[model samples]
Target: MNLPGHFHQAQYPKRARWFMAIVWALITVKCGVVWWAMPHWNMPTHPIWVVGPTLIFATLVTILWLAHREE
Candidate 1:
């Protein structure tokens, strides 16, 4: 028997988008925390090691989230 049409087309996309949004929000919040916490290391070149990874991670996460958006 054929299932409901909206299940495959509309609701699926909405659910996927919702999950993706939550994951992205979590990642953003984590980045925010790291941005402030990194400096406490008291190292002279802390930015090079800590800030660099934070930026790279945020960029990669943003790209992945944007690329796999639901239609």
Candidate 2:
């Protein structure tokens, strides 16, 4: 028996995966550096400063992953 219709899945290239990996790595490193610098620079330690970007980044990555996901 066969299904009623044909379905096409989205394709994600190896290069795209590598690019995203690098992007996430860089973001992680940047966050670490920011945390390391905050105290040394005598900057104000506000929760929003760190958490806001992190949440936004997470949301963006989730959207990107879902958009490129295979059906």
lDDT of each: 0.60, 0.66
Supply the global lDDT for candidate 1: 0.60
Task: Give me candidate 1's TM-score against the actual structure.
Answer: 0.47
List CA RMSD, all candidates: 8.6, 7.2
Top model number, TM-score: 2
Instruction: Please give the distance, in angstroms, between residue 62's alpha carbon in candidate 1 and its true position after superposition.
Output: 7.1
Query: What TM-score against the true fold does each predicted structure earn?
Result: 0.47, 0.63
The window of 10 residues in a row where model 2 has the poorest summed lDDT is 1-10
**Total residue pair clashes for candidate 1:** 0
What stretches of model 2 exceed 4 Å from their correct place? 1-10, 68-71
Q: For each candidate, how many residue pairs have backbone atoms clashing (under 3 Å)?
A: 0, 0
Candidate 2 accuracy as TM-score: 0.63
